[model samples]
Target chain A: MSTAVLGAMYEGIKHIFKHTFTMKYPYQKVLLPKGFRGRHLLYMDKCTGCGICAWICPERCISMVPVTDNKEYPQNPEKRFPQYWYARCCFCHFCTEYCPTGALDYTPDYELAEYDRELLLWSPERLSRPPTNIGEYQSVFHGKDGNQGVTFEPVIKQKSK
Target chain B: MTTEPPSPGISISKTAEPSTLDVSVGPQHPGSGHCRILIRVDGDYIVSADPDIGYVHRGCEKIAEYRNYVSNIPHLERPNIADAIHLNWGYVLPIEELQGVVVPPRGKYISTIAAEMNRIMSHLYGLAIMQGVFSGHTTIFMWAFGDRDLFIELAEMLTGARLTYSFLVPGGPRRDLPFGFEDRLSRLLDYFEKRLVEYDRIFFSNPSVIARAKGIGVLKREDAKKLGVVGPVLRASGVKYDVRKVEPYGAYADLEFDIPTFEEGDSYSRYLIRFEEMKQSVRIIRQALEKIPKGPIARKAPLVAPEGEATGRVESSRGEITYLVMGDNSDKPSRVKIMNGSFRNLIALPFLVRNVHVADMPIIYGSLDYWPVEADR
Candidate 1:
């Protein structure tokens, strides 16, 4: 029993000098993979107002709204676009898969926290705007255990993608 | 008042018997999850334990009737989101059989990878919870959860979601392998392998843990089968039954892995079984990645399935997960019944806890690895 306690303590102390596993969230963030599904980014030009994304959403979070801007999308006569309610969105990205026009895409901006519930709903115009101040951190593996430790090198990027 | 001499080996029923205290251990207890256990105790020893489940029941089967075939994927995986791929496969495989949609060889390989990844994650999560229960060993708990993040990160890289993948569609996986996946996976596997050794030295080999767990809740081989316990609990009781081994599906038929079983049937053995399973999962992942072939990931599936009832089964992280999906020739399924492993294993809970100390309750409970949310669902 005494030996076991001492061994466990040694194991714990061994990690003291090793780098911490957690990312310093607001300051340092994980570098998400290429195909990460985070926040919805809408392309108004290629959308074609089909509402396939709205139809395919299991949560019924996406609704088709009439487009007021005719100058931006001259080809679209349907005068409709998708407005997303983030409150109900499960972020399954099923809509992205079902989108035939390839207009619906996801940006790796997972931080969707807001002060008000009403502000959670994103209009087509709001969804079209790109994400700002995205944090990208490079993961460096150190130590021989393969599990020994990881150090995150924070790489701040201006572009969302 | 003079007391009569205690009967040898047996006690006769009397008009006025010694009263046993009934203590209800939670719907609110942090250790017990959403389910409650009503225990009848004679002093410190439990006389009887009755599990009261269904706190988190959301009528998952009933909800399956309203949604279309594709839409049901996300909802079906909700029962045990940690092992979502297995649940996803259980539901999708039946739908595939009904629709005659054959997943290609590559798709099978990828599914195997994702399933194994989910299994490792699920086992780690269970171990973390079990560690917490075993004398508040917060070190192992933190280590397990921290390492679990590695697998979760891999899952997110592969399937695009952290918790609910919804990656598997009826025909095949929603997406193919991403760039730099194999390299990242191999490194993580090596690290995880080393961590397992550390875990053994710290938690499993700890003297205090063994004293509490060993011979505490011994479910004999006969009793295990009789009680209909499934998963690690069943395996720990010496029944070498794994649905993957019995009926191989997807890439499991082609792959090679051993089903770890223990004869002891104690809480310690159950803990060991999970660790062994995690190691096996790692082996399976390495093999699948090495032997993965080049082919179409998915076959073209129809929007609607035919009118028929088909059953699909898979070895989930917990145990055998079987799905009975009945399609009414519509876009939606007429009925979907999910038989999860946790519910099947719950029958042994009362038997195991009986005659055991109140302090050993958490160890026995955690050994069973019963997820009340999955059971209730």
Candidate 2:
């Protein structure tokens, strides 16, 4: 009985020298993997005004609205694009998958917090900009002494498309 | 000031005996989720426990009617977020049957791997929160949760999202195994196998935890059979019943693994049952990765289903989850009924919680690994 208790104590004490597992969120962030279902990135040139995204969206968060932009697209003669309401979107990526023209793609931009409810809605123009807050740290494991620890390494940013 | 009499339909009278006191354990978060156990206790001993559930009811069945077959994947899986793949798989099986869609051999293998990985994650969540924290062992809780996140990262690598992976569609898994996935998974398993030894030394074999759990809530084999408990709870009671073994699904028929069982139906055995199952899950995943065939992962299934009612069952981390779907030759189902393990195991809660100490209540509750949200849904 004494040995068992001492064994448990020894295991607990052994971890004192090991590296910590958790990260300091907001300051330090672990890089997300490829094909992460974060936010939508729309390509204006590829979009053909097909409402398949809006129709297939389970939450009905995507709505194809007419863009009054000055830029003309030969593919999208109707000038209609999908505008997303982030509040209603479940990020299931069904919209991105069902888009026939491959116009919608996934970007690793999960920080969608907004103060006002109205600001949660993203227009086609807003969705077109690249994500700015992609983290640079990747979680890597050290192989020595069976001491499981994460070491951050520099990440090469890849285009979401 | 005048005190108003009790309302006509409501009874304000005390239900407990003169010596016993009625204590409501929760309508709030009671370690697990929102579930209130109205226990009638005399001194330190509880005479009876009546579980008050339905606090997290979201009318999942009713809402399933409004959505199409594909959309129901995300919605139905909300009941058990920890074991989302199993729940999602259970809902899809019936739709696939109704649509007459068979997943390819490779798709079955991938789904099997994903499901087994999910089983490990779900069991780890139970170990961290249910057993570890309830037993007041903070170290095990931290260790288990940290280990679980490694699996979560791999899950995110395979499926797009981390937890609520709508990875399983009607025909098969959404994505194939990523590059270097096999090597990474095998390495993680090796590290996890070492960790399990430390877990056994610190938590399972530890005297304090064993003393608290060993003979606390002994449900005999006959009683377990009579109660119709499913999953690890039933298996711990020495019933060699598992949906995977009974009605083989995915690549379970192709793989070789044992359904770990314990003779003792106590809280300790329940805890050990999950531990053993995790090892078996590891074995299953390794075998699946090795024997995986190279072929088309998914077959293109039709959006609509024919007019028929089909029932499909999958062994979830908790227990057997059976989904009954009735389609009317439309995109949406006419009716959907879910019979999940948590709700089925709820009867065991009131049965076991009786005649035990008030302090022993949490240990027994945690041993069952009952998720209130899943039960209420």
Candidate 3:
């Protein structure tokens, strides 16, 4: 009985020497792996103004709206583009897959917090531009054998797709 | 002030010796998740435990009726967030049967890997919650959560998302295995195996946990079968009835892994069963990764299905999750019924809590691995 107690205490003390598994947010951020489904990045040039993304959305979060200033394309005369209400979007990336023209893609920018509810809505113009100044730290495993711990390693150069 | 009269067939009586007090443990308490348990206690011993479920009911079945079959994947998986892919598979399996879409061998293999990964993740989540419930040991809770992230990372690499994969579609998974997935998975699994040893030493084999858990809320094998408890809780009672073995689905048919069972039906046995099952899950995953065939992940499935009702059953991290889907000629399903393990296991709660001490409430309740949101849905 005493040995069991001592063994448990020893295990607890052992973890103290091991590196913590937590990420210190803001100062040090772990880089998300490739193909992480996050916010949508729309390619307006590739888009034929098709409403497939809006139609296929499970949450009904995307809607097609008219963009008057866009350059005219032979395939699309309506000049309608998708405007996403991020408040309702589940980020399932079904919209990205079903878009036939390869117009939609997901960026690894998941940190989309806002003080106001209305600011959560991303317009066609906003969705067209990719997120910047993100993802530098890569999660690296520290320790040998079965007693392993996770730590973040900072990347020297920025990653580009 | 006015007092209401008693209803018919009910009598209020003051006992001769001592009064039985009623204690309500949340629809909002930290220990009980989203559901309330009203316990009638005679001094320290509990007379009865009435589980008040449905605190987080979202009417997922009723809502599935309105949405199209393809779009309902996200809504159906919300019931159990930790094991979303299993729920997704259960809902999608019937639709795939109705639509006449046969998943390729590779697709089956991929789905099996994802299911096993989610099983480990779900069990770890359950263990973390169990630690919080019975022992309030933050060490185990934190360690479990931290270790769970490893599997979640592997899952995120395979499927795009971290938590709600929605990776399982009608016919097969949405994506194929990513590059270098096998090597990373093997490394993580090795680390997890070592972590399991630490878990046994620190939490399971700890003297305090053994003292609190052993011989408390003991359910016999006959009583377990009689109560129809599901998942690890049932296996702990030595039932040996797993849906993976009984009606094999996906890649589980080809897999060679044993269903771990314990003769004793106490809380410790239930915890041990889950611990053993995690090891089994690791074994199954490694086998799947090695033997996966090269082929197309999915066969094209139509949005609409023929008029027929089909049921799909898969062993979820909880237990057997069965989905009965009735499809008309339209794009949307006519009716969808999801029967998960949490509600079935909930039947044993009142039965097991009887004649046990009040302190043993968390042990019995947490041991069942009951998720109120899943039960209510």
Best by lDDT: 2
- Write the residue-wise lDDT of candidate 2 on A1-161 in tens digits: 99999998998888877777777778777788889999999998899988999888888898899999899989988899999999999999988887888998988899999999999999999999989998767666776524465555667668999
Tens-place lDDT per residue, model 1, A1-161, is 78997887788788888888777887877887766888889888888887788777887999999867646676567768899999999888999888998888978888888999999999999998888856678666776745558767765567877
- TM-score for the A-chain in each candidate structure: 0.88, 0.90, 0.89
In angstroms, give how far residue A142 of model 2 lies from its true place. 1.7
TM-score of 3: 0.95
Tens digits of per-residue lDDT for model 2, B48-164: 888877778999999999988888888889999999999999999998999999999999999999999999999999999999999888999999998899899899989989899
Worst 10 residues of 3 chain B by lDDT: B7-16
Alpha-carbon runs more than 4 Å astray in model 3? A146-148, A156-161, B1-18
DockQ of 3: 0.74
Candidate with more favorable, higher DockQ: 1 or 3: 3
Rate residue B284 of model 1 by lDDT. 98
What shift in Å separates residue A158 of candidate 1 from its native position after superposition?
15
User: Candidate order by DockQ, highest to lowest?
Assistant: 3, 2, 1
Give a tens-digit lDDT track for model 3, residues A33-152: 778999999888788887888888998999998886847756667878899999999999999989999999978899898999999989888999988847677666776854557766
C-alpha local distance difference test of each model: 0.86, 0.90, 0.87
Q: Score every model by TM-score.
A: 0.93, 0.95, 0.95
Q: Candidate 1: misplaced stretches above 4 Å?
A: A70-72, A145-147, A155-161, B1-18
lDDT of 2 at B178: 92
The alpha-carbon lDDT assigned to residue B224 of candidate 3 equals: 88
